[model samples]
Target: MFDWNDIRFFLELCRKGRLTEVAKALKVDHTTVSRRILSLEKQLDAKLFESTTRGYVLTQAGERLLPHAEAMESASATIQDHVGGENRNLTGVVRLGVPEGFGSQFLSKDMPSFQALHPEIELEFVANDRFVSLSKREADLSITLERPRSGRLISKKLTDYSLRLYASRDYLAKHPPIKTVEDLKDHNFISYIDELVPDPQMLYLSEFVASPNVTLKSSSIVFQFQATVAGAGISIMHCFVADEHPDLVCLLPEEIEVNRTFWLNTPEDIHDLARIKAVTQFLTELVDRQKKKLLGVLE
Candidate 1:
């Protein structure tokens, strides 16, 4: 029989797709990870992964074995939770893929509180604009712009948030008064590069002005926000983030509002795991408590 311990290495390799990353996660040497996989393959008499320029791609046998290994992992976790008395102290690494703005500007501030509450849980954030694949185990859970239409995933609407055009007090002081959307055409704007935007929902600038005088373009919302705060130009920004900066003024809030939703998704197989559940609960509560701010309901 193959050593069950070797299955952990196999699963981690499948998720991380790199011996070095799997080794770091498993706290073993990369050579040890390779040796474990070699041993596992020999015992099973199967080729599991193929190495290519893009890293490890699973072979047909590895793909076939994936669900079974995941089942074993789930069962092992359940046993630890109930039989090993680890339920009382949830301890595991849960990597969450989130949009850069939400992860860095919003959720990052509250992470300390979560750490205080669940001291044993190791939370890692993959903050970026690109979509992460839960099927590939890119992340344990994700906060995405749209609900995934297909996958072995469970998804729910996390929250509906608002974005509005904002300008710095310094910029407004120097420029012409903007009473309507048409007036925006003459003013400088900071926006995402049109070709580089990952999703249609992120194309907020075009909704208001047909031809904006875009002075700077960046792939990062945080960068755009910083530029806007420096009196660089007007840019559509999340109210939750922009409102926090007193110097940044929301312009034409009623005439130029863009709404978007955040979806929380986790693989169905691991959705019930204590660590995953804890993180999801924390996100749900966090969004719920911040509804007013997220929705741009000024108090």
Candidate 2:
């Protein structure tokens, strides 16, 4: 019979794709991870992964076993919750994936309060522009700009936020006159690199300016916001982030306005976990409390 512990290691290795990372996650030595994988392969009588210089790539055999292993893991977690009484205390790691702007400008500030309340629940915050996969367990929960269409996932509309065209006061002073949307075509603009923008919605300039004279391109919204503040160029920025900056001026509030909703997503398998539910509740309450600021109505 194959050991369940070895299967656990196999699942982690498959998810992470690295021996050292799996070892770190499991709090075991890298050598132990290698040994367990090899032992599992011997028992199963099949090579589960292809060892390459790049990293461990799952073989056909590994792909076939992945779903089974994951299902077993889920069942084990449920069993532990009931049998071992892990449900009594909301203790476990919960990884949250959020966009760059919300994670840094907004959520990061409020994390201290959440941590204080649930000190036993370890939290990992992943802030990036790219989508992190919930099916692969990349993150326990994610805040996405667009709702995911596929996967056994549960998503809720977290909140609606507003974005508007902004330019540094110094930049507007030096540039050509900007009385209407037509004048914006000639202005130096800052936006995400066309190729690097993961979602088409990120290209907010396209809504107003047909052909923008992009002076600078960056993947980070924070970087673009800072550049706009430094008088680099006019850029579309979230109101929640840009409103706090005194140097940035919102342009043509009547003509230029964009509204987007953030969706909170969690996989259905572990959605009911006490820790996951707690974080989700916390996020909902937090966003509701700050609704006015997110809608760009407050100072």
Best by lDDT: 1
- The C-alpha lDDT values of all candidates are 0.91, 0.90
Q: Clashes in model 2: which pairs? A: none
lDDT of 2 by residue, 1-299 (tens): 99888988998888888999999999999999999999999999999999888789899999999888988888877666557764466778899999999999999889889988888888898997677998788999999999999998999999999999999999999999788999998899999989989789989988988988998999999899889999999999999988888898889888999999999999888788777899999999999999988988865
| Cα lDDT tens digits for candidate 1, 254-296 | 8999999999999987888888899999999999999999998
Which portions of model 2 miss their true places by more than 4 Å? 82-89
| Each prediction's RMSD to truth | 1.8, 2.1
Clashes per model (N, Cα, C within 3 A): 0, 0
What is candidate 1's local distance difference test score?
A: 0.91
Q: Estimate each model's TM-score.
A: 0.93, 0.92
